[model samples]
Each structure stands twice: as structure tokens, then as C-alpha cells.
Target: MARFDQAEGLRRMLAGPKPRVFTFLSALKEDEKSGMLVNLGVTLARQGNQVTMVDARASEDSIGAWLNASNDQTLLDVAQQQRTMKEAIKIVAAGLSVTMLTRNADCMAKLPPEGARQLSRVFDVVAHRSDLVIVDSEINLEAGFPLASLDDSELVIQVSADPDMIKAAYGLIKRVSNRLGRRGYGILVSGASEKEARLIYTNMAQAAGRYLAVPLHYVGNVPDDEHLRKAAHLGRSVIDAFPKARASLAFSRLAEQLAMSARTTLGIEGVPELGVGLGI
Candidate 1:
């Protein structure tokens, strides 16, 4: 695999279209979130997009952990000048790579001012090198993201059909809105049929709009499929391991919709700037 070059990445940032960064927060189990991220990343990469999955949570259930990435090296190390970008990024497939934002979730908050700035620069370079960056993250106790740039990225809330999960998902949106103020968020329902997903999205959207005045876009859903679990057990994405599986088809469709959305929004004015210095 080719290594990431900082100079080239910087040039790309300046000359090419802005990369789309989507930070996902899940109200489901940890394994479910990790599985969704892995399959989605693989599907996007298979579609010929330059995709990078950044594990911002750094917990045992994070995407990095799901991929069995070494915690010793991370983007934080690169920012601290202890490791190179190439060393930090692990290429999982042709166009898919995974990197951990930090070894610990609280590490970002502990960084000094200069360190925080350097971390922001490192993240900027990494994001520039990819066409799509998928961030597996969680809002901290203070309802702030680990990186300031994530505050400006597209925020997606993942939920299931379970009542508890739906409630938790809505609570998450409320917490984020309380901190970030009014902003649109994408909704992704996992482990549900089309009808169920639509209903879930509608109810949640109505509540959000009526109470919080926040707009929620339905990004689509992933149906319940045992093939997803089997693929994960085989250390492969459903699209790759079980191409004809229902989950595989769902993932492909989801990836298509997300890619289309990204293209349509490309070069649009008023897109929030990313990779700003961290204040968290």
C-alpha cells in the first residue's frame, strides 16, 4: 500500500474538493456500532472511494478494537512527533484504512495548547488525504467531541428498533443539541425493516423538529441479518464475504446514498470548516 505523504495531503486539501467527514454516534451496543462501521467502510471502499475510518472513541469497542489495531501507535502519536502518519494508519483494504484518533478518550482533553494545535494539524492532513472519513465517536460527558473539527462534521445518530435504544438515541440528540445549538443531523436505523426504519425516523424527526427545532435527515437503514454477524466472525464485511446476503445489499444501498449525498453537497458554500484547533 502507498504511504500517506503530508506534503501531498496538504496540496490535495488546497486544490481538491473538501473531504466529507461523518462522525457516528450510536445508541446501540458497542459491537453493533463497530460492525456497522466496518461494513460501511468496506462498502464505501469497494465503491472506489478513498475512505478512512477513524476510531475516535479508542475504547475496547471502538472500530480500532474491532479491527484489532495496536493501541501503542495512533494519530496522537503522530501529533506528538513520536510516530509518522504512515505508521499510524493501517490499510485494511484497497481504499479503506483505519486509524485511532488517540489511545485514550480523555487524552485529547489532557493535551497542552501546542499539542492540541499539532493534533488538529495532523487530523487535517489525514482528512485531506481521503475522499470520505468515517469517525466512530461518542460525545463526552460534557457533550463535546474529542476533536473540535468533529463539531463541524456531519453528525449521524445510529439507532435500533428497540424502544430503549430509540429513547437513548433521542436523548443523545438532545444532549448534542443542547451543546451545539440547532443543527441538522442524519438518522440511520440499524437492524430494522424498511417500514420499521421509516416509522422510527418519522417519529424521531417529528419530535426533534417540534421540540428542539432540529432537522433530521433519514440516511437509510440496515436490516436484521445473521449474515452480518457471520461476516464479522470471518473477519470480513458482508459485502465481501456474503455478497448475496440481505445485509450486504443493504450496505451497498446505504453506501450509494451516502456517496450521492456527498457528491451533491460537494463545493457548496457555507460548509463548516474542519480541523480547527481543539478547545475540548
Candidate 2:
């Protein structure tokens, strides 16, 4: 088989209506993070948009693991010609698919330049085929994302009302700004009322602007609801299991807000050239 042309793949990625890519970094526990992503993804898919949730962490606590999608071959495997793209992305729900960046967290950093480029090509292909791509990721010890493209993707930090988690979220934003230079980030507060979420976002936004000169956007919040836990235990999304639940309503509203923002704010001109900066 012939090798994929990195330049061509990048050209195609930039030539058309680019898909909205949102990389989520969370201060919540692994399970909580995964749960939030699952509900959000399902809600988005329910709105008729083709969505793909990429498990870039690939850890036992990643969304893939939470969805029992860990056994699927990863994008790295596709890049290495060990698996086909069709075999890599698994459909977990209607209009929603899941794929892994790499089975091992360190594998990406160890890839050669050619291997890295190939992986980037695979990611570009994935993005072009979807309306939106949600990355459930974390910054590695090297202070970098698994893919360079993620560095340019819309970044959202999921935090909660707990003081410790709030502190950790700010620290994460600082760490990212220090590495990637000053840039805006979206803040989503989980397990809090609307008023509490606003307070958290305001305080964090002010602090970030004053200290790091980073702009923060309030991307809305999810409330504390027992229905969310019940739906999870039933292996179903909150919207599907309990559409009348407060958390379900919140997810639907969030999905609408995000989808509209994505369509209006992102276009072909906003598409970043992939595989340019290999690492962080």
C-alpha cells in the first residue's frame, strides 16, 4: 500500500467546511469526566450532527474504557497500517462514534517523524468525516497533547464547585498557557447550580485575565442530579433514560449552545494546518 500524503491530507482538511474540534481537559475525577463526555456526546448526536468522541487519554479511566470501547484498535494503529480506519472507530450510539488516539499514553511521544505525520493524516481524515469531534484528553507530563492539532482545537476545561477542583482547573489553565502561549479557553462547571457555576466562571475568568492574560468563556454547566447517576448505572444517556431530568435538560441546552457556536464561529478559514508543529 502507498503511504498517505501528509500535505494532501492537510490541504483537504483546510479546503472545506472544517469540523469543530473541542478538546476537554477536566479537573473532575476520571469517572466524572467520562460521564460528562458521554452525556454531552449523546445529546449532540441526538440533535442530528455526526459526532465522534476521541479518547486521546487511552487510560483505564478514559471515556473509551467507560464505554467499554477500549478493545477497539486505535488511530495510532491505523497510522501504523496495523488496522483500517473502519476497524478503529466504533459506533457506540446512534450518530456517535468513538476512537482512541493511541492505546498507550507514551506511544505518541515515541513515534518517529514519519509515524507522527501519518497519525496526523489519520486524524485529519477523521475530522473531515464528522460534523464535530470531541476529544477527551489531558496534557501529558511533557505539557503537550497527543496530537499537535489538539493544540489548535477549541479547549474547554471542565471544573466543579469544589475549591480543590477549582484550584486544580486554574493550575491547568496556567500550565497550558505557559506552554502554548496565551489563548482563550472555555470553562464548563459540572455538578453545580447555574448561579454557582456563574460565580465560579466569573472568579476564574477574572483571575485568568489578570494573571495569565488568558480569556475564558463560560460554556455553561451541568447540575447535580441523581438521575444522571441512575442513567449511568443503566448504561444509557441521561437524555435517553430520563429526558425530564434536570441534568438531561442541561445537557440538551448545552449541546444546542455548543453546536450553534461551532457552526457560526468555525469555518474553512479557521482550520489550522495539521502536522505543522509535531509536538506541543
Candidate 3:
């Protein structure tokens, strides 16, 4: 991969299109989800988009750990007045900023009014600074989506080829549609070939359309590439460690598509408009 000029990339993203935050809700295990988010974030950052990743997981496994970033402070620290969002963010590969929110007493509690306000403030600060945000969110449609993950942002539900994983993904989509109302959802399949991934999406999409009257959008997939595993073991993104690998190529394409989708969703031909407010 060619080296990207960070200054030039920021300028391009700022002048060309409005920024976007994509929240991915996945039923995959903690490690899998964390790895995927790291790959996506680094790929987007390398492609010249200023990306920030928010790790909102309840699991011990962390995206920050995968990126080899120190988690001295988190979003909770910002909420509790221990640190600022700017202060909490750890800069990682290709200038990707990450803030990890591990499971804690406060993280498990219902959102308090004051906490919500602090989080909103953090959201505003983060939104202003970055060209793209990838929210590695917890899978909990049972309580509706998080406020930071909502409003004018794309929602993606990551799925795998396993029967149990497909069932969980469908159930999540059904609950989210019921709670949040009918909306578009991007289905990103992992651990499968293009042909297999298409089949999985086709089956799930058909079921969602028939049973729930919901439309599922396919956001593409990553093949079961061995290089991804090796890169993960080395604490580096496949794009960085093995740029010619199959998974690296897939992630590059996915990042390009996501940027195009953001431009298409929010028209940015003229001056950029402010994004919707954070609602919990």
C-alpha cells in the first residue's frame, strides 16, 4: 500500500465529504469483534480518513489491546471528570485515535442524566475532530441502542456463517427494528468466501424481509484468510503486516465503500452540515 499524507488526507476528507460514524453491533465473540474493528479502523485511517474507534464492550478482550494502545483512561473517565475525551484518546496506527470503555460498575448501570450529558459532550468533541468514527459497540438490543451510536450514523450488524450466529443476528435485527422502528441495517459477514457470504446474506435478507418486513443491506465481507490470524498474533493489522494478503485487499475495498456510502448518505457538495444530536 502507498503511504498516505496525513495532512493531505485530512484536507481531502474535510473538503470533499461530510464525516460519518459507523456503529457496528455484532454477536461475534469478543476477540473476533475486536479484531474486525481494529482492521476496519486502521484500513480507513490508512486510506486518508481521520478515524477514531470507541471501544464500548463489556468483555475483557479489547480493541485497544489489539492495537497495542495504552488504556490509561476511557470514556467513563470523561464521564466521571477524571479526564477529557481529548485526553483519553490514544493515537494508534495511521493516526487512528481510540478510546476504550471497558466493563465497570458505571458501565453496567443504566444511563444517568448527568452521565448522558457528559457522554453527549464527549460525542460532540469526538465528532468535531475526526473524519470518520468506528464505534465497536456492545451487542445489547435488549436495551435499545446506545445514544452515541444513534442519529444520522450508519448501523452495521456483523454476522458469521454459523447457524447460531445467524439466529442471533436476526434476533438482534428484529429487536432493534421493533424498538427503533423500521430502518436500514448493513449486514457484514465474516469468516466466509464471497460466494458463501452472499448465500448467507441472501438467506438472512429473505427471512428478515419475509418475517419482520425489514430490509438488510450487504456491506461486504472478509474471507477466512490465514494472514489475518498471523497479523493478529503479531499485534499488527493485516493491512500493515501483509498488505498483499486477501483480507487486506477486502478491508481496503470495504473502507472505500464505506466512505462512498457516507458521501451518498449525507450530501457534502457544499458546506458541511452538523450531524444529528446524540439521543440516548
Candidate 4:
């Protein structure tokens, strides 16, 4: 038998610098949200996008589920290591192409004296190393937590689409905008839907723009893809199984849209830039 040539494979997979932050609500129980995120991440990765999901919530039903995490380590570990955060995450993920931040609560209980400064530096480094730093913050982590660290992102996309959900998203968006210190722009839509995805979900988009006052780029509504079920059952990304599927296509389109948005609107050319300072 021959060696798997793991290093060679990684060199091929992570080739450029593209990082984006996308944190979701902790309100979603792990069983529901984590699978959706895994579905989203694997789909994006297959499109040749580098994505590192930080499980900020570390709840029983989040990225915490993957490592059997009892606490969250991404922000803390990244901040503590400073320059090493990017290298550490890439190395860890390179070791397992589809991995997430472990859930370690104690690690996040309180920040060190210069924790915020360390995190900002880490974000700068990771932004250059990966195609996208898809962070997952607790849905309602209040304002002023590390969620604001996404200040550097081109845009902070809020992910709820239902009207009732949009109502809650308003409060959430208000806090985030206050944290980021502006009107706040983001994608406001759901993850999964039925056949005729557009028809089923387009109304949600219309309502979001009307109510939330934010442009809601509709990431494709995932069908009840069997591969998603299988992967969740086995605790693996569907890309590791059915690399070519509707779910995969949706994420690819989403990644493309993000790249486009970054170039035109994120204030900087073809990458994200911090929009507002914490005025509130």
C-alpha cells in the first residue's frame, strides 16, 4: 500500500487567502443548527472555498457536538496563541479537512487583559490564510461579545427568514449593528426548503428586505437531501460522500455570491473591511 500523500492533498485544497465570518443564532438547538451549518460548510468547501466554523455557542446542539465538546476553545485559543491562531486552525483542519471549534465554556468564561486585542490580530492573520472564516456565534450572545470581532468582515449576514423569526432577528440585528455601529447588512433567509426552492422561499426574502431593512441574499433552500441525513447520521460532511448534489450546488452559489458581495460592497476591494466602530 502507498502513503495517502496527505500533505500534498492539503497543498492542493487550501491554495488562496479568502476568509469570511458568518455566525448564526445559538437559539437553534444543536441537533437542528449544527447539521445545517455542516451542510453549509461542506457545500462551500467543495466549491474550493476554505471555511473554518468557530462554534462560539458551544451548546450541546452546535459545533460543540462534533468534538464532544464541553466548552468552546476557538476565540480563547486563538487569542492566546496570537499569531499562531491561523496556523493552528489550518493545521488542525488540515488534519481533518472538515472540523470545527471545540466547545469549551470555561475557556470562554472571561477574557484575559488583552484578549480583545489578541483576537483582532488573529482575525487579521486568518483573513489572509483561509478563503473564509465562517464563525458561529451564539445567536443571542448579547452585544459587545466576540461577535463584534467580526467588525473586519465585509458584511455580517443575519440568517433567519421566517416573519416571526424576522421579528426576533430585528432585535438581534439591532444589537449586532450597535456592536458594529451601523445599519448592518446581511443575508436574511432560511437554510432548507421544499422542491421549487425559490417559489417556496422567495416570499421570505421579500419580507426580510421589507421588515429588517437589510438586503437578504437568498442562499439556496436545501431540499431534504438524503446525503445530508446520511452525513449527519455518520457525523461527516456530505462532500465526503456525495460531492455533487443539490445541496453542494447551493453552497457553491452562496460562496460565489459572497465573493461578489465582498468585491463590490464590503468597502474594500474584493475582501471584507470593518464597517463601524462600537458607538453603542
- Model 1 CA deviation exceeding 4 Å by range: 1-19, 266-280
Q: Which ten residues in a row have the lowest lDDT in candidate 1?
A: 271-280
Clashes of 3: 0
Clashing residue pairs found in predicted model 2 = none
Off by over 4 Å in 2: 1-19, 266-280
Q: Report model 3's TM-score to 2 decimal places.
A: 0.82
- Cα lDDT for residue 65, model 2? 89
Give the Å shift of residue 122 in candidate 1. Answer: 0.9
Candidate 1: tens digits of C-alpha lDDT, residues 50-78: 99999998888889998877778899999
lDDT per residue as tens, model 2, 171-211:
99999999988777888889888878888989998999999
**Native-to-model Cα distance after best TM-score fit, residue 273 in candidate 4, in Å:** 20
lDDT of 3: 0.72
Model 4: what TM-score?
Answer: 0.65
Can you give the TM-score per candidate against the true fold? 0.87, 0.88, 0.82, 0.65
TM-score of 1: 0.87
The alpha-carbon root-mean-square deviation between model 2 and the true structure, to one decimal in Å, is: 7.2
Number of the top-ranking candidate, with lDDT as the measure: 2
lDDT of 2: 0.84
Question: Which residue runs of candidate 4 sit more than 4 Å off their true CA positions?
Answer: 1-19, 67-75, 81-109, 139-141, 154-166, 178-181, 191-215, 259-280
lDDT of 3 by residue, 223-246 (tens): 888999999899788999999988
How does residue 131 of candidate 2 score in lDDT?
86
As for lDDT, the candidate ahead, 1 or 4, is 1
